[model samples]
Target: MAANLFVIEAPGKRQALAQALRAAGVRDVLVLATIGHIGMNPQGFKPLAIDSEYRELAYRLKPDRERIAREIEDAARAAKHIYLASDDDQEGDVIARDVMRWCIPEEDKGKVLRVRLKSLAPSEVRAALAGAAPFEDASAARGDARRIVDRLIGSLSSDEGAVGRVQGSLLLELQSKTPVAGVMTYVAPAADGRGDWTAQLPVFAGAAVPDEIQAIAPLAVGASRQGTLANHVMAHDEILLSASLATERSLAEVSSALQGLYERGQMTYPRGKHCAVTPEAVRRITAIARASGAGFVPGLFTAVREPGGEHSHEAPNPMVIGLSLNRDLGLLPLDEQILVHVARRLIECGVPCEVQAPDPQQLRGLPAAAQGLAWRRRDAKGAVLWREPIKAGYRAWTSEQSLLHFMSKNDLGRPSTIVAHVSKFLNRDLVTQDFDLTKKGRDWSAHVGRLFGHQNLSKIIENYIEEHKKAPSLMVADMIEMCGLNNIPTDQQQDYEYEDFEISTGNFP
Candidate 1:
């Protein structure tokens, strides 16, 4: 009898998921891994080809993945049913579609189905297989659009090394910003003698320190007001930021570790951008928190619904209730550290607390020297006199956390792609680890800024996805012209080549 085939993106998931499938009584199924994207053409000026008018995408298997492609084709030919279980996101949908186009024969196309395995838990895997559906064409189209647009931008501006819709904008944003001279932080012991509360002030060059602030060594607190803590759950970017800070690892390193935990079913999907967790997920986390003796307050966690429409994923949380991070699951020290942070976040989610601080209006009524010591009073000077906390609540955010939050708010890139973009910038020396732009980076940013201002490229892509949902077509030439980049050299204009994989127009419909 012909076997059923299940394809996934990560090789690490094959063993565990295969076991889960077996346990779920999913018989005669062969699990396979794509490793990652298979559409990259190393030798071509462009990674893939796009039809000038219809915006249809043509992809070629990378040389290194040729054997894997052949294996997929052979397996697909013999398989009774083929499940493209890569991922449920846009990138994953694109990968699934590409597998069908490049590997499965025309006759075998009907057997192909898309399965979204949000987690590798046995139940989730079983449910995903049971609910397998057709490939998401719109999501695949959006992924294709992103690839095409990024490739077109990079190829046209080959002189600049690597440029992307989001990456370029981020580079320009970094290049355009002026660095602050210094920062002053003030700390005071808690009124209840618990710990210290702190505040910060940014000092620019040539800015003078206020005499009043300098005089106030330990600021006195006046009338205090009670405030509720902002019950904010961590998003993907924030998790990355927190993990990176806690582990002293790079964002890329933390992301890799988190992905590893996810593959092993120790954590939820790591690339989720939302702060909300599903009601079921919240319940699981709460149970885990109680079992693990972590801080668990019933009905305290905020933001517990899917806010980003139907396709949006829940925030990352521990996958297994009472899962041990120290278990000998081949977890690295970094992975364990990151997993601990994730578990802590889940346990702490929705735990209510109160905060007490000096009233701003009351502080303003004080003498000039006392007023200079007010929290976040920049007018007097860039020095925070002191911060006294009456109650414990939310934790202070780090600089990197603030930056990632900003990036997320502005849609600089998806959670999955943001770390890679940052790593690319660092590897290419475009931006220093400290986020300062080098001369080359600055020059390139200036050039790209002239063609497409910061955020314009992302906006154009967004608009394209929204307007052309059916036949998403944004030609390279059209985008160039849209960006006011009309003076392209003749040689560079015609550099891209198309590899025909015998794709027929009928295949698309």
Candidate 2:
């Protein structure tokens, strides 16, 4: 007998989700897996196909998906309704679209439904089944646009061809960095006996203090704030950055392991575009921190609510309540274990520091503009009151946390591909494992410097997409010429003779 069909994307989640659904008293549902994507752009440099005046790329299903497609067809025929249970993301929506096109019979198409499974927990799955929504057309369209652009870029900068826009840009950015050097300085509030104060004096900005500033030693110096340091919660990219830097794991491996944890309901969604956490997530994180005997406080993390938009999701967190990072999940690999540690530290960051205001007299010499009014310096007699040495040097590489934080702040790549793209720099030898300099050359450096410096590539791509409205059939060089920005010209092609190229409608001279 045919049963209601539930299609999932990941093979690993199929058994778990099916068991969860059964536990929730759901019956007559046969869950199946697409085992990730089944179709991709056709081979060759042709990313665009012209058909009946419409330009669209052909997506061919892999031979391996034939059996899965057949099984879906058989199940769809018997089922009264088919729920496309896929991950709640753009890529997931595209996968669902493919499954729908390949498997769901046309006559029974009305029976097909789209449901977003945020997690495979029994409650989540049951809730999804009860309140499943229709497939999101906007998401699918966005995915299609991305795929077209990606394929276009890949075709232009194939393995044997010139480096692509992103690669060229990053390389340029790193190569142009002139390593800066300077002296460190420190300052603290100091006042005359009569209690007259001055603004904060200029401290140094280098490794060691100059003899001039160190000569004006302060009478007293103490901590401006007390209690533990409150660092902002770590994001997924930050975790990956740390793990990749510290351990032998690549960004891809670390990200995959983290996502695996999310799919199994051990952690929150691994791929989120923003670092903002919902109130519920904050509460759970607080509870977890407190349970772990870390001092956790509420209202410490100022929730940066995102103005509504597509692809905005909360920071990665634990979905399952009371998940002990140390005891409960000890069996995960060392790298995955680092993810838990990073997550815990992020939660602990919400424990606000207990700050005590300094005495007004001590603030006498301190500048009113100075927020942190404590420092180490020498007194007039040259006695070291206290020395807080400013540590600054060349950081050849970065931890997952720092990299993730920077990228998130700058609105870089999407959660799904941030690590993948970053690892490419390592793989391509643009930078070393320590993030030290490499010999990628000047053109690459200029491209990267321009990209990171001005963040113009996105603008260029956006303009191109808006103007063209679709992927162009032109070669990479042609696309670069039309990108409407001063991209780094290909080294060999820079001196080539110019000629007008024929575009879709007109000649781009």
lDDT of 1: 0.62
Report model 2's TM-score to 2 decimal places. 0.66
User: What tens digits encode model 1's per-residue C-alpha lDDT throughout 206-252?
Assistant: 35543313322333343443222334667788888768766766777
Angstrom error at residue 313, model 2: 3.3
How far off is residue 439 in model 2, in Å?
6.0
Candidate 2's C-alpha runs over 4 A off are: 19-25, 46-54, 121-131, 136-138, 158-161, 175-231, 243-249, 278-283, 298-310, 321-336, 355-412, 431-455, 458-482, 485-509
**What shift in Å separates residue 28 of candidate 1 from its native position after superposition?**
3.7
- Give the range of the ten consecutive residues with the poorest summed lDDT in model 2: 500-509
TM-score of each: 0.76, 0.66
* Clash tally, candidates in order: 2, 25
RMSD per prediction, one decimal? 7.8, 10.1
